[model samples]
Target: MDPVNLLFLVPAALLAGFVDAVAGGGGLVTVPALLATGIPPAQALATNKLQGSFGTLMSTWTFWKAGQIDIRSMLFPVVCVLVGAAAGTVAVQVIDASLISAVIPFLLVAIALYFLLSPRAGDLEAQARVSLPVFGLTVGIAVGFYDGFFGPGTGSFFAIGCVALLGMPMRKATANTKLLNFTSNVVSLAVFALGGQIIWWVGLAMAVGQVTGSFIGSHAALRFGAKLVRPLLVVVCLAMTVRLVANPQHPVYGWVSGLFSG
Candidate 1:
């Protein structure tokens, strides 16, 4: 809550919003910045959701106005995400998150590789591999729960799901990702609010930055389409993977250290 911290966090949120709007790794920036301010981890995560909601809302609105998202078709997925996020948020209060922390770096690496190697990952809409209902039940619930529980690369998860499973173009995938992400974020934010974990002033101040950044980022995505989104998605996932493993306490670091010592 120091004015000094605000000066740092608000700008971080702005940068986060820009990256998140385009490819969905905003938390990679904002969460660490929040933590660095010496807040409790729970409060930092809660405050993150509060600021992130503004960014997602702004990007979602931008995409909607641009005719990129179809809200009515997304209703079921939204409901599924809401349910999953609510459950995950509650579970996180009691569960140890170390396991997830250990596993996510590998998963992010895989995602980055998929984006990097896939010839047609986000180029165009193809035939859906699964029905909408199936996507809602599977990706919606799973990624929503992940967002509520751990929440770093949620936008990437949603965007990839929309592209690979639902067969959406990159721009449309990014648009819908924001909407579904907003759903999970709001559900998690509400639970955090109920637990009295959020710092309103900090969250609100960062939100101003988030809104401005999201507006610009969403427009850039619209302008450049796949060329912008695909590379950013790969970079964000890779960056998140590195950030996660860089933590000395992260299980991957320990595992690698043991391997080298052995």
Candidate 2:
């Protein structure tokens, strides 16, 4: 990449990391930036994952150090996410993603509304609605698969699941989300790397920005707790929903196209 184009990615990656650390729609920014650089779609996706892995890892470390994530307790969910992501990566090649893509925007709207309308949401931990095993199988594995397959709003989905199903506070939810996000990101990044899809120099430059921004964002989340995370999660999810729904390849967009054509 040229110096100008490469330089443009730094700030974009930084902003993405900051948003991702808080609410998880970082790819909503970085992936578009990579595509704007005129890389092929596959390379753009691969490079975005490469940079995203760094930001997620930084956020996970920051959360872990803050005593938010208990690795021992989370081990099962972590493994579930890893396995789910790997499966999703393979499945995407065979399955049509339109069904899931069509549903995600509506799901995001519901999640956003639940957070917005529920006064007690993300405020404090309540009794979990599901056991750890069930949560791991349903939310953890499902979201992990979604991350590897479609991936626009994986963080927001995880955060919502943590708050609503797992009954965790926003801060802890954000911390745990990072762990799962990092796991899925690493899984996808490795596959992309093996496929020779990543643009290494570009990925590395953006990764530096991602790490720095993620560090700052994670600390901010720890300091501000629910106050910062809740609103940001809503915004990021809605934004991702809009992005996906507007995509020409998305099923919803295809419906829109048919409407206009008719």
Candidate 3:
């Protein structure tokens, strides 16, 4: 890459990591930046995984260290996510994604709306409706599939579901999101590596930026209450959903098309 693009990747990855840490859609930023590099779609996606996995890992660790995660209860869900991601990746290989693409905007809108309507409850004082195992498996299977197929609002979905359905606080929900997000990324990255689509040098550079951004983002989340986080999450999801609906694509993903075209 030239100096101009190299410069761009740093800031792009940094910003992507920060937003992802705060809300969960860093790909909304990094994937387009990769596409803008004029690489192939599969190649860009592969390189994105290479970089993103690192960012997710850093965020996951940060959350864990900060006393946000409960690993024992999370085991079942993490495994479910791994299995679901593998299944989704395999299914994507055989089926056209047009149907899911058509439906995703609605799904995102629902997620955003759910949060909007329940603003007063379910952040810190929420209660779990099922055993940890049951809850984990449910989210793991459903969201894992979504991540592997269409990934615009995966983080947002994970965060919100844990908060609303499982009655997790926003801090705990954010931490748990990182863990599951890490698992899903691991699945996708493995496939991309096997296909020889990753650009390691660029990925490593982006990872540096992502890790830095994650640390900053975690601090922001810790400092600000969910009263602040709640709306930002909704707005990001709304923007992502609208972007997907108008363009008839994955919304957040449409930016990738522009990058390659430009």
Candidate 4:
């Protein structure tokens, strides 16, 4: 809220937006920054989403304007996000997220390994494998649930889902991901604000930076197309998975997370 905080946040937001636009892990950057400022974790997540919405909106708009996204039928996914996330948020109060945390590393590892092994997985800009409407509905519900319940690495989830199910190119998948992500974030933001948890000034400062960073990052994706996008996504997913497994709190932070136990 102060000038010093604003100064620190501006840079953080811009970098967060750029990372978000590039690979869908901006929260990995912005959430920690918010937490570092002594905010509660819930408020930090809510405010980060508040600021992140601006960049995502810009990224989505850029994709739409460039003919990279099919917006007319995007409503189903967007709406599903709003509904599914509301439910997920409510359910979280009763459900333990420990299982999800335990499982997600394996999921990320599998996704990363798939991409790493198959070099041509999403490289071809061919006809989509699924109908637009069905495609939209499937991912909307599944990812909406995830984003609503536990939201780290959501961008990666959407990206891989689009590629694996719809056979969409990575560039287009990233664009569409932003639109769907925006809807989910908006739903969560509304809830957080309702609970009086969002830090308005912090969200505001970060939002401004999000717009700037997203514009630049969006253009970069447009320029490089799927060739650059898919591999980078795989790498990011792998990195995020490793981070999750390590938990940053385990005795063997680097090596032991791969060995799983029931």
Give lDDT tens digits, candidate 1, residues 7-93.
999999999999999998899889999999999998998899899999999999999999998899999999999988988887888
lDDT against the true structure, each candidate: 0.91, 0.90, 0.82, 0.80
Candidate 3 regions with alpha-carbon error over 4 angstroms? 248-262
Superior by TM-score: candidate 3 or candidate 4: 3
Record all residue pairs in model 1 with backbone atoms less than 3 Å apart, i.e. clashing: none
lDDT of 3 by residue, 2-29 (tens): 6577688878888888778777878878
What TM-score against the true fold does each predicted structure earn? 0.96, 0.96, 0.91, 0.90
Candidate 4 deviant stretches above 4 angstroms = 248-262
Estimate, for each residue in 1-262, the C-alpha lDDT of model 4 and write its tens digit: 4568777787888987877886788877788788888888889888998999888999999989999887777777777777777777787778988777667777777877877888887776656667766765677777787888888778888888777877777788889888889888887888888989888888988899888888888888888876677677777777777666657653344346445531
Clashes of each: 0, 0, 1, 0
lDDT of 2 by residue, 1-262 (tens): 6779978999999999999898889988898998898899999999999998999999999999999999998899898998889989999989998888889999999888988888679889888999878888988899889988878788888898889889999999999999988999988998999999999989999999999889989999999988888888888878888898788878888888899999
Q: What's the lDDT for residue 165 in model 4?
A: 77
Best by lDDT: 1
Residue 81 C-alpha lDDT in model 2: 93
Tell me how far the alpha carbon of residue 68 in candidate 1 is from the true structure, in angstroms, after superposition: 0.7
- Ranked by TM-score, top first: 2, 1, 3, 4
Candidate 1: stretches off by over 4 Å: none
